[model samples]
Target: MQGVPEEWTEEDGGTGERSRGTGTGKGEETMMMELTRLVQKTVKESSWWERRGIDCSILAAAFISLPPAFLLLGSSHFLWFSAGVLLMGVAHGIITIKGTHLASHGALSESQAWAKFWAVFFIEICGSFSALAGVKGHIKMHHAHTNVIGLGDSSVWKVPFLSRSIYLFIAPLAVPVITPLVALGRKYFPVERDNRTVAMVTLGLYSQYWLLINVSGFTSPLSALLCMLVCRAMFSVPYIHVNIFQHIGLPMFSPTRRPKRIYQMTHGVLNLPRNPLLDWMFGHSLINCHVEHHLFPFLSDNMCLKVKPVVSKYLTEKQLPYQEDGYLSRLQLFFNRYQELMVFAPPITELVGVQ
Candidate 1:
């Protein structure tokens, strides 16, 4: 209720009639339309062929590369085996984060049925997270209401008991292990028409386990499990880190004083410098093109990158805040202000006089 928009409220007149024009509704509309045009121009430049190719290639790499890496475990060469496992883990992370993210937004396919199929396959099956839940929680809640406390604040990862070092550095390692358990645990809560999805995801995870232990001819079950965990850890750490860094330290607002679309996105989203490691796995949208991604959530990673200059320049010319900070700086900020920013709720500043 605190985060509800002011425009939705009506002032009670003497006759008990409601007034609807209290907020900067017209100004917000204008800003939204201007940003929408920029997004449309970017969309016109995007090619479906390129998007499909990138999606297919990433999916293929995730599925195709891992089997050979698992086979390498039988070699018993420590260095070679470790290298293979690392590669497998990075690839799996890409599938889980990038692939699942795209599918969750329905960006991977033109057809609704095909999009649903892919979202279920990549998110629930490969990523070991529920697709339906992700769309409702992530796309609908997080994206729609970024930096709004109790909605898009991303406080789920906050562990008050753990010190900054442990919470930031060590706890993330458990994300790969924790994710599937959380997914299964969600079944106890009410979700509509989700029984089949839960079953499929459970079966899919079991199928992967069976592949490693029985079919892949790993030295032992332990080896198979180790391989899976290693790969998932490669993804889980940065996945948690990026999620926090992108929006946590920036401006937050109550629903009544929430900024217009462009202002909210630019003010709230902070882009990290491009890192080769993260860029390749998480894709551009998760990396330096984050502001662009927040502006156009449906855009492919490549498209997000392509439109960066235009969006950044427009915001800069307009004298709006377009935040960019180095990855290390953000980590340090979080470390220094962990209590203020992470453990407790971030303070909300009511945006005033923005048209």
Candidate 2:
């Protein structure tokens, strides 16, 4: 943990995701409130098409994975298969980072079991993570303590002197490789049920990978393993980078800190509206509609994009934060704030008020 601070409280309970009327930004007054309302209005009025777009992306991600799987079945060309797997793997990474991550937070829907299963399928089955263990660490630990050292996933494998700009690019490539080791290492050393799942899932994934490649006659057993490892390594780079963009470089608060939910979210996290074509392909899960996703996880990526403005308006009327930095601006911030941004910090422990 980086460091715990004081705490905040409103009439309802303590610091939480919801607003209870009383808050610290009471001083920013009217203008901020108007912005919040505007944002919310925009979110509310979002069109059906936008929502559909998100869904398309999700399906597209899955679609992209199929060809490579098919390729391994027929061809033994390691390079060709590696390239295809690398692409689809990236798709899985996007869905996991975006869809599964939100779903795990119960942000998707109330169907706890469905969310749980989706989380496992996306992260463990595809993106290479243990669903339960990832949640325990992500929802319970990381989200609970955004940038607190040793808590947040963002901070987990950061290395000093690694440039923030490059780090974002590098992390995706690292995740498929590093995250698994971390999961397996923890299980190997101390042992945890989720960790055991890690063992099981890893075995399953590799077995499937090997069986597919070999049965496909794409390569000899030796060659298939080599190709799989290479694809995973190449794929990890961008997957990690995309994950980093979703949340990092925003104002972090201790448990005591009372930043408006809107501000905390907008500034706290990022929205990279990049690769419109790819966004059409995998952008939904790559940080697009992020604010809406956080606000309403289950609202298909399509729904979130449409309602983003409406939500923004409501948040605006409430005089909350509504940040949407340009892609370049965010990239710069990551470069400037990588270390602190990646590390997790503990919540503040202060007065309990209607913050």
Residue lDDT tens for model 1, 1-355: 1211222122311001111223446655665567668867866767775655676676677778877866764466888777777767877888888888877766677666677778888888887887777777776667777787777777777788899989898999998788888787776344654675678678877776787776456857777787778767876767888999999988887755576666777888889998987887888888899888877776677777778888888788777888999988988999999998888778896667773
What is the TM-score of each predicted model, taking all chains together?
Answer: 0.88, 0.67
Task: Please give the lDDT score for candidate 2.
Answer: 0.52
Candidate lDDT scores, in order, read 0.74, 0.52
TM-score of 2: 0.67
- lDDT tens string, model 2, 1-355? 0011111111311112344223545543443465445545655576544534456456555656666665643644767655666664555445545555544444343345555555656556665666666665655554444433344436555565666655667545555556667656554223555665676668746865766555556446666655556555654554555556666555545544544444444445556664564454444534566665554334555555556657667666655556565666666676776665653342332223324
Q: Which stretches of candidate 1 lie over 4 Å from their true place?
A: 1-24, 188-192
